[model samples]
Target: MSLPPRRPRLPLRARWSAGLATAFALALATAAPAAGGKARAAEPPYEARLAPYYGQHLDWHPCGKPAPRPAAGRAAAARERGFSCAEVRVPLDYADPGGAEVRLSVARKPANGPGERLGSLLLNPGGPGGSAVDFLTGYAGEHYPEAVRARYDLVGVDPRGVGHSAPVHCLDGPAMDRWAATDLTPDDAAETAALRRSFHGFADACRSRTGELLGHVSTAEAARDLDLVRAVLGERRLDYVGASYGTYLGAAYAELFPRRVGRMVLDGAMDPSISSRRLNLDQTAGFETAFRAFLRDCARHEDCPLPAAHPAANRALAAFLHALDRAPLRTGDSTRKLTEAQATTGILAALYTEAAWPALRRALAAARSGDKDGTMLLSMSDAYYERGADGHYSPLMAANAAVNCLDAPAAFTGPAAVRAALPDFEKASPVFGRALAWTALTCADWPHRATGTPHRVTAPGAPPIVVVGTTRDPATPYRWARSLAAQLTSGHLLTYDGDGHTAYNRGSTCVDTALTTYLLTGTPPTPHTTCH
Candidate 1:
């Protein structure tokens, strides 16, 4: 599925979430460009003036030490896999290359084995807002097959407004704590107004603190930046492995540089053709599918968290959510109560990967037992949201909103549109439907307009690209992968009939081998390669 909103994403309440950690954002927006807005004109042909950037060499240094992995492991894991951090200077606004320029933060883990280097394998884990720098060294660099690593240097770039690039700073911890806890499932006019105020405040904070950068963080610009990064790395064509939202970014790059696409793998593919509303609707359905799978798996296990679950897991889940909605659950930190929103988010976080299912079971059991810890619900929510131990929050969500709202037309015009859509959203997913419907409104108030349309990305002359989809992916749906693969001129579809947000290295040697072989040999999987 395309990481939409920000995805290819769900809405803000859904968030770049797949959490408050595993929460999938509310995928959203209605069709086409907004009323009274003009599409951005095609970029000027690559001009001579851009050579300074494309040709400039980056000064590399040891990547900076990450914040200690909060004793809680909420922050990214300690980046033990070493990589060189380099600064790439690219135009803040590509339309005006000579104007102000921003320095993008990039990291590289050089080839390890004794083999000819096959250029850099640029890596991104999606999020529009996901950090590629840490990803390059942490999970990716550490886990990529040794053979693939021997031939290609791993590269990561924190797109213009994300991570170490010109970071987007909005609200601080206290403000974000309130923002994250704002209830999307509003009951009364007062609650509705409060939620609106929260969305409004978030939008206002971003605009106030980073307005100059917000409008420019569009995926198109980020794609252009990707090209510059490619050229600067001395690679004539791009080789990439992008997941989740990264799939959309990778697809954009291929569309922009069809001729320069050497090898690409879009795991958890996103359909660039849909509107934000459709993205939300599809993701709602997608999550329900994943959640159902989780239910079956949990119910069969001896250690399943809910002994009384199943036969009707959806009803059980709904009841659980409703229980929290009635009264905030007490927590170890007396000051922090697990509100419905936080509880819902915590539950969603575990749905990202099956490995988290048991943990979810355990957390839920404690909460049901009325443990003051409120179980690990709040903790899991905090992890998915990237809440730090120091009470600070990363700018990921803020930047996620910035890029998402700018990339697509508004999914829900305002509260009324959302109210009307609730039934459909609920139909899509009884558990997550209502909250998701409300999040589509997050972008209706965005300050900028979209430059892209819901058009197919054929990448007409690009080299072969690998597009992956998991049958029961919780974030990007499997159909999106099928759709994206069909759209690309040389796209190869690799299906993992499995669960989780992504599929490359989760557990299937079948999927992993297919991907690494393609990356190493320049051979795409047969047009239709299904790995079960």
Candidate 2:
């Protein structure tokens, strides 16, 4: 029930096949030369007001040093791989273009081409808070398919109120540590009051530190920012690859600028038609499905720590977490103990991908041991929270809440509503239901009122857009993808009948080949295409 981070910093070993070569060849044959033209000119009086912003130039330079340690090295490596960074200025409020402004941090890896360049392909690893800049310079810039890289200038923009782009600040490290350890599921009225206090304190800190900017970080604004980015990059149309929550951002952009959309691949899609409450419940069920899959896999191995039977395994894991709530386990760090919340976070982290299941197994086994070493699980929890070794936390969670809270009405207005919803939530996922139901209380005390509402995005005139879904994605459910694909006027659903979050580069050659072809040649796979 921790808000799912879009792209976890987990090892994603790439697997390629001979089919990719064929796809690449076909792509090259159809690919067109990159145009140096500006975006289609804006229309009318509103366009006149926004002219200066759209007309400004980008001053690209070697990427800046990242705050995190090893990241400095990654930035250098990205520079070596033809990556550069820049800042694009946009209005803090699009409605008031002449008002305060924020600068978007952007990183670009120019096309590595012996073939025709298609244009800039924007990438966003969604969080509503994820740093697309960090995602590019750290992993995707170097790891995306060489075929796609050969013809496209890969660009990543940290949307306003995220990363280096005038980020939203709430609790500092120590405060965040305390907040993260707060009991998520209340056992009684006193505990419930404590949880309310935690949410209120977080909201208060955000209002005090983030100021007016906190109210403006909605996905709708972020989508407008994406348009500004596209224009500044001199693209006639936007070509993009967005995963998880990024799909919603892309959908918004398409709805707003349908004709400006080009080749877009939305992997791990979110259904824009659903309310925040529905999204929470659906995601809760998704994670439960993923957890069960992990348990089944774990049961096959001799080192598995839980009972082989599914129901027994679920009960056993639940008991372990509940026991931790009563008496936390010792992590190697003397300063920190693994509470039930942290353990749940750690378990959810592994459920993002099956690759992390063995690590989860090891961590659980260690915690069950006499020594009660909780180091591994604690480490994973820290990673999910984007906490550093130096005990500093990123603004990821703060910005995540800011954007989400502003995008929709509170899932539940107060504890009473949450209590009323518990029965339904618990039925959705016995292990995660209660905590996730409490998570709905997060936006109840937000300083800003909701500015957007749930609605289906048709993007009526947009070009063919591919929507990828994993059968067992833990964060965004496959059904959401189906719903989104059905909603989008031009959507093509490409299904990966496998486990894990997104499908494109996880391991499926079929998924990768289809996606690569679409990006390179503007051809969508057949509708409702299923790939194993």
Candidate 3:
């Protein structure tokens, strides 16, 4: 979700009709017959349901269902860390309670200085695929303000199809390389054809490789699984913190579990109401806004890649990218070419942080001089979907594509559609429009049809939820934060006039203070709050 490679709209125009036959056949096989009629045969079981109903949208309460305690063998491990790990079985499709099941990995860090520790505070890091357990053990367990950490158990569960929970793998390293290197903006018929082929190839590869789990990995199901974790952890209500995509998950949980209200914080919130196309386009503009800020700083520095004396560094930067679009330069590496796509990705990587600005200036300077090494590193940063040595990739990029495509509609069908929309895109982000416009084309041929549409996330009767917005956030956009805050009755907007992806846990006294206070005392700051 970060802008590193800062990187979706319609139901009819959005969907691909190529796989209609298979989808219909599957649908018929799974469609439930009318109840109590002579031909009221039961439709296929939940196993046949392809639409995912997992994650933040369902009512999930603690099942009070006892589970097998961790093996006595792990006693020493628990004694040392004051935590234990367990597993819970949840339906692959929540709508079909009697269907096949999947195991969810759950971890519990019991409270340290508690007076009968309050309920568990579940945590999710926001990728439809980020690892929650990793977030907890890595940061939430130790870095969360002491007051909140001291009174409640921190529970982390990697949502279905993410991290350790039966992860989905779609491509090998070489195959992924080809996918990532695919040309984004096709200028003519031949290139357009190539773009379509690449799109289809990506989708087909995902289907042939990881089709089974694609239908089971919705956000709604993940929410229900969380509820089961809540019950197993013996918490009466869920106390939690979710960031980025995690905020969407939390809001989804509130919509489904208003009665089981508890303390919850959704930092850097997303508005579910935005269409895929709109989301991508808006995000493109957001990155442009952030890039301008970076350029402004660069214009003042002596080492600025685009010289400040020129008084047109930003324009020059844009021209350099355009020139690269026509002719890619070679890096020292024989295998790597600094194509426009790679250069655009590098620019996006810099957009994520002020700390990255200097590096970006250096990289841009290097690229201007026909050396692509700096740009290569920036592309690498955006492609951080995984960490592997020898330039290998984990299944994350594939999985990321899988989850995102299934959850939402495609934004553009081909280069022609994108070309038609170029003016609008340019209006949004003259700096990065074409790259982002091309990026939106990836989902054009996704195999699955989404079950829901973008809609406002409002969970009435829920406790106060704090929504954090960075004034110049490159990824989620500040306006999205503002809109999200306005959408929720319980939402309190906390604005950080800064640059970067998210505000909290980064540097900012105001953000840290406000969030820490709310997480600890369950009291939100006043609405329209600003922290510079």
| TM-score against native, each model | 0.90, 0.93, 0.81
What digit string (tens of lDDT, one per residue) describes model 3 on residues 349-398? 55655656776677777777644454444354334434343466544455
Better of 2 and 3 by lDDT: 2
Segments in model 1 whose C-alpha atoms lie over 4 Å from true places: 1-45, 65-82, 305-311, 370-373
In candidate 3, where is summed lDDT lowest over 10 consecutive residues? 21-30
Give a tens-digit lDDT track for model 1, residues 19-48.
Answer: 334233223322222111222223546547
Per-candidate Cα lDDT values, in order, are 0.74, 0.79, 0.62
Clashes of each: 40, 0, 16
Per-residue lDDT for 417 in model 1? Answer: 86
lDDT of 2 by residue, 40-143 (tens): 22356876899999999999998855643324546777777678999999999877999999888999989988799999999988777787887787667777
Q: Candidate 2: worst 10 consecutive residues by lDDT?
A: 22-31
The positional error of residue 26 in candidate 2, measured at the CA in angstroms, is 34
- Clashing pairs in model 2? none
